[model samples]
Each structure stands twice: as C-alpha cells, then as structure tokens.
Target chain A: MLNISNIVLEIFNILMKRIVLMGVIILMVVATVYLWLSNSGFSEGEGPYLGIIALILVFAVFLLIRRIKSWKVGEPQEDELSKKVMVRTAALSYYVSLYLWVFLLYMQDRVTFDKDRLIGIGILGMAIIFALSWVFHHFRGVPND
Target chain B: MTNRIKEFRVKLGLTQEELAKKVNVRRETIVFLEKNKYNPSLRLAFDLAQILNVSVEDLFSFEDEK
Candidate 1:
C-alpha cells in the first residue's frame, strides 16, 4: 500500500534534520562570539578556558544532533560507502590527533602560549583534522581491500 | 572486484540518480560502484542486482590479484 502520509512525514522529518543541524551550527557560532567578546571577570590566564569550553560544547552538540537525526530517520543515515569512509577518516584522524598532541606537548616548553592555550589548540586541531580527513576520504574514495 | 553497474544501468536507460534512488543509496555510492573504487556490502550488492534485473554474478565479478 502506498502511504502518502508517511511519505510526507518522511520529507518533513528530513527537513527537520537539516534545520536541527543548521541551528546547532548557528548556536555554536553565537556562543563562540559571546565567549570571545564578553568581558567577564576572568583573569588573562583563564581566557583559554572559554575557547576550550566553546569547542567542547560545539562538538557535543554536533554529536547530539547526529543522534537525533538517526533517531528521527529510524535508521543510521550512513550508507555502506559513508560508513567505510568514516572508518578510514577516524583511523587517520586518531593517528594525526595523537601526533598533534605530542607536537603540542613538545612545544609547550619552548612556545610562549600557556598550557591551557596549547590544550585548546590541540582540541581545535583534532576537530579540524577529523573534518579534513572525512572530506579527503569522501572524495578520494576509501581504497578497496 | 569489478561491477557492470554502469553498463547495465546505461542499457536500462537509468541515470545514476535513478539507480541510486531505486537502491536507496546516495548517487555518490553509485558513482563509486561504477568506478570500482568502493566495495558494496552483500545486501547492497543484492539490492543493486535486483534493481538492474540481473543476477549477482552477472553484475559483479572478482578479479584475480597476483
């Protein structure tokens, strides 16, 4: 039986997922702006905490958004190719992020940036590396075994 | 492994987007399949074969790697 209502509902659900993702991104941007611009009574040494907090918040929100999207769709959105690409991206980013952390640790003593700032940079770098790895795998194709 | 997905799809007058829709996958997946770059799961292979009106063996072939 052709369920027209279900089809319409599925379309609406897909739109809702897009809206949720966009909302999360907008909120992340606004929160980042607020963290940087608002002069609370925090000391200069405490400023890095704001960036780290914003980064964590955004990451958590994105994960939550993915969960919500899959829940709404009644299945994981990732198909076979996407799942493979995701696995490759995760493996690549895991090694790269570890290298980034080690590099940051090595430079902490020599660099003027404090440990807190270095931590923030490490978190941001990890996220960027993961995103870039995904893009690369998605376009370049995960090599077949 | 290599697949005749593009050949069969073309013979059937179906575009990549149409085939992807029939198989419930993204167009990019069909593109990869045609290029023999990404390996599809058994379920996906069965679905694609069914949609193309061909047997699984007729759709995909294993190449000897020496």
Candidate 2:
C-alpha cells in the first residue's frame, strides 16, 4: 500500500506550494511590463488608472502571499529562523535603498528624469529585494517534510 | 555543544526528513544539528530527547563546552 505515485504527487504538490507566491509575483511583473510596452506612455485615460492598478496589485499580492504562507504545512509560517531572515532582509534592503537613492539624486542633477517614476522605482527596488531575499532564505531553510 | 543526535537518530532508523517532521522543523535544521553547527533551543532539546526516548543529558554532552 505504499502508493509510490501518490507520494511522488504529494512531493510535487509541496514544491508547487513553495513557489506559488513567487509565481504570482512573476506573472504580475510580466503583466506590468506588457502594459508599459504596449503604450507609448501612460495616456490621459490610462495614467491615473495605472496608479490604481498598481495599488490593487500590491494589495492583492500581499494578501495572497500571507494566505499561502499561513496555510502551508498547516503550521505557523513565521518561525524563529524566518523572523531572523526577515529582519536581515529588511536591514539589507534599507541599506540598498539608501545607496540607490543617493545614486538617483546624483543622476538627477545630470539629466532630466521624472521624479515620480524615479521614486516609484526606488521603492519597488527595495520591496523586490526584501521579498525575494526573504523567500529565498526561507525556502532554502525549509524542512523537506 | 557537541551532541549525539545523529547517532540516536540512526539507531532508530529515522531519516532526516522523518525526524524533522516529528520535530516540526525543516530537514536543514536536523542536518545542522547533526553536524553540531546549530544549537538547539531548550524546547527543541527536550523534544529531541523525548523522541529518542532518552534524557537530554544522554543525548547531548556539554562538558567539552566548558
């Protein structure tokens, strides 16, 4: 009654669950890129709407990630090592963002750049670094149960 | 901080994954423990000892740390 196929499928399922949040993030990034590429620039009708779309996507991604983590393994997702990794991620992201901001400010004096876009990109950079680092560390450390 | 976790686990014929599942930790945690690279929390020490059917002192020897 070993049911080797069932065991293989079960392992596959856990691997899928582990990458679920990362997959969603990738899809969202692709959608945003597609949107940006199709338009010469945010048109009058779409400019304001882009902000709303970004906001909605951000919230949706946040909620979905939390849901997936909490439900994974039916155990508390934030263990001691996870907390430590998160704290480390946050600290590293802060330093990275700080350096990036300084570089952006320096480049601003040399060329005309949209301040809003630069700020948005800076924030996005920090968020992606923190999120990806956290996920990488957690998954690398996760027990293969 | 050296311990006999691996020895006891092997004696019981448990894989790292099985022991990790029993302790509700990741397999990496067990690997680190076996290599004496990670120290266990007091609760984890108790859990491991209970799982191995041995007292904490029997599982981990700390005189070397002194």
Candidate 3:
C-alpha cells in the first residue's frame, strides 16, 4: 500500500540526500578546477580569467554555506553552535565593511570615488563575509559533517 | 524567570526531544528553557503552554526584580 505520508517522507529524504550529494560533488569539482588551473601555467591578465575564477569560487562557497545552514541530521534540527558562529562571523564582516566604507570616505579627500570602486568594495565585503563565516564555522569545535 | 516546563514535561512522560517536536523547536531550546539559560518569546511561550495544557502564566513566572 502506497501511503501518501510515507511517499512524501521518502521523497523528502531522497531530495535531502541528493542536495547533500550535490554539495559534495560541487566541492570536488571546484577543487579539481582550482588545482588544474594552478598547474596549467596560465599567466596573469589572461582576459580576466582569474577574476572569473574568483567569482566562481565566491558563488560556490555561498551555495555551500547555504547547504550547511539548511542541513539537519540525527536529532537536532539546527546546530546552535554553528548558528552562533555564523552570527559572530557576520557581525565581524559587518564591522569590517563599515570600517572600509569609513576609510573610503577618507580616501575621497585624496582621490575621487567612482561607481566601479564602490561596486568592487561591495563584492569584497560579501566575499569576506562568506569566507569568514566558513572559517569561523570550521574552527569552532563543530566538525563540518 | 522561572517556568513549569520541566514539571509539565516530566508529568507527561515526554523527553525534551518529544516535547521539542510537539513545540517545533530543538531539544537544546527545551534544555535552555529548563536551565533558564534562554527566555522564550511571548509567542513561543504561548505555544508551549498550549501544548502543555497550561496557561502562559502557569508555564512561566517573572523574576521579582523584573
């Protein structure tokens, strides 16, 4: 008998498993690509390829963090420690971005501020937030499962 | 603040996990409540009290200073 609740539960489990599996696959692929690019002797300023690579990495890390945040297994729905770590990291990033903006105001006295520079700073802020969140989460006694 | 969560949970023979499931929260949240490490929001306290068959006032008491 195909119970509707049972079928829904099974589908949910399968979807969760697939999401986790996909995260692992993406990490592996990113690692392989990074390694291959580093080994390929691609010189700098090759049509902004390095910039493209960094963008890809930033996106990949963002997805990975989202996956980790949503992950729940073996009795606890959300990890409190991980949540704390994320909050702390985000706070730090916010402070850093604020300081950077203040510094930019000071720089305005010496040079003109442009839209491109502002956009670059925004991207840098987000990248720092993503990277620091992962680093804090990884180091804070909670093993990445 | 003090609460009757532990007493009610015990009376019902429900582990923190079971009560948490009924309340839609993590077990640690229940532990935090029992230990008074965390205070529940008004909505959460109301939900918990409803599930435990008690009024919010019955579930939680304010500290005298507060």
Candidate 4:
C-alpha cells in the first residue's frame, strides 16, 4: 500500500494518497510537539499527547526506512538560523491566531457550529497558520527592520 | 543593517554551502545574510566574522533608521 511505482499508474494513485496521509500524520506530530514544548509545564491533558507523539515517531521511523529518502537517521536537521526562523514564526502565528479566536468568538452566537467543532477548527487554523508562516520566514528570512 | 559577508567569503574562496557548513547553519541563512535581509544574532555574527577572517565591525554595520 505504501509503495510508489512509475510503471503502474492506477496503483500509483492509491500509493500517493497513502503517502500524503503519512505526511499529514508527520505534520500533526510536529504541531503537537511544538505546542507541548511551548507550554510552561505538562498538564494531565497532555499525557495522551506525549504517547501519541511517541507512537507517531515510531511509525514515521518505520516509514523512513522504506519510503522517505531525503532525511538521514540521527543527523540533526535544524540549524541556528532555522531555530531563529521558527521562534519568529511561532511569535507571529500567535498574534494572528488571536484574531482567529476573536472571529470564532464573534461567530458563536450567529453560527450553529458545535462547541467541539469550533474548538477543532480553531486548532486546525492555528496549525495551518503556523505552517504557512514558518514557510514564509524560512524562505524570506525574518525582517531586519 | 548591512553586511559584507559575501565579499569576505568570496575573498576567502569559500562557497555559501562551505561557509554554512563551517558555521553550522543552512546555506539559505548565508544567502539572506548576504542580501542584508536578516539580522543575525551577535554570536552568529561573531562566528561568521571569524570564519571570514574579518572583524565583526568590518563584517556588519548598522545604519540608523531616521
């Protein structure tokens, strides 16, 4: 199910979907780790998240052995500049996420969305914003001024 | 802020990749630094200056925005 092939176009579609699913899972792991680490201390609610991240990392490593080719095992990926970029991106995303929350709060009375779904949307929006902001800063660099 | 990192690096016959490797940063960081778009940390500036064999003052200068 995970194998990608050049010869068979039909099976390739299925494999591509699987690959994308794996990628999303990895991204979720990154988001979870970022949020967990950014917090001052671990809460009881975070215990399950830690377990989830561990399981995801193990699965990701298994995938890495067979599928991913770019990343090396045990090699450090982040550098000093990348760290700076992440810090800046995280700070920027926090401010933007507040507006999203305010909008959600504003919509609570008008919109029929369930409380759980609304909270889920807010979390997803934060992740997407963080990812996009990180990409922007990674390529463009944080503004000197 | 403006930096002469590219000038000094070229004089030392080092590519951006090589300099980044020496300084333990990504090559993109060097590209941004050379373009004067990123203000590097003091430690990074010191490390880069040392690698390029230039003083930090010679490598980077700040222009006050009036």
Runs with alpha carbons beyond 4 Å of true place in candidate 4: A1-76
lDDT of 4 by residue, B1-66 (tens): 898999999999999878887887667778888988788888899999899988999998888888
A8-98 in candidate 4: lDDT tens per residue?
6664565466557777877887886887578857778557646645554664656544343312221224556677888988999999999
User: Considering lDDT, which of the candidate structures 3 and 4 is the better prediction for this target?
Assistant: 4
Q: How would you encode candidate 2's per-residue C-alpha lDDT over B1-66 as one tens digit per residue?
A: 678999999999999878877887766567867877666778888999999888999998775433
Top-scoring candidate (DockQ): 1
Give me the TM-scores for chain A across all models, comma-separated: 0.61, 0.50, 0.51, 0.51
lDDT of 1: 0.79
Residue-pair clashes per prediction, in order, are: 0, 2, 0, 0
For model 4, chain A alone compared with the true chain A gives a TM-score of 0.51
State chain A's TM-score for model 3.
0.51
**Sliding window of 10 residues with minimal summed lDDT for model 3 chain A:** A136-145
Docking class of 1: acceptable
i-RMS for every candidate (Å) is 3.5, 7.9, 9.3, 2.7
User: What's the C-alpha lDDT at position A108 in model 1?
Assistant: 79
Model 3 lDDT tens row, A46-131: 43645654675766666566555444533433445446546767777777777777777687778876767566666666665657
Scored by lDDT, the top model is 1
Per-candidate DockQ vs. reference: 0.46, 0.15, 0.11, 0.29
The top-ranked prediction according to TM-score is 1
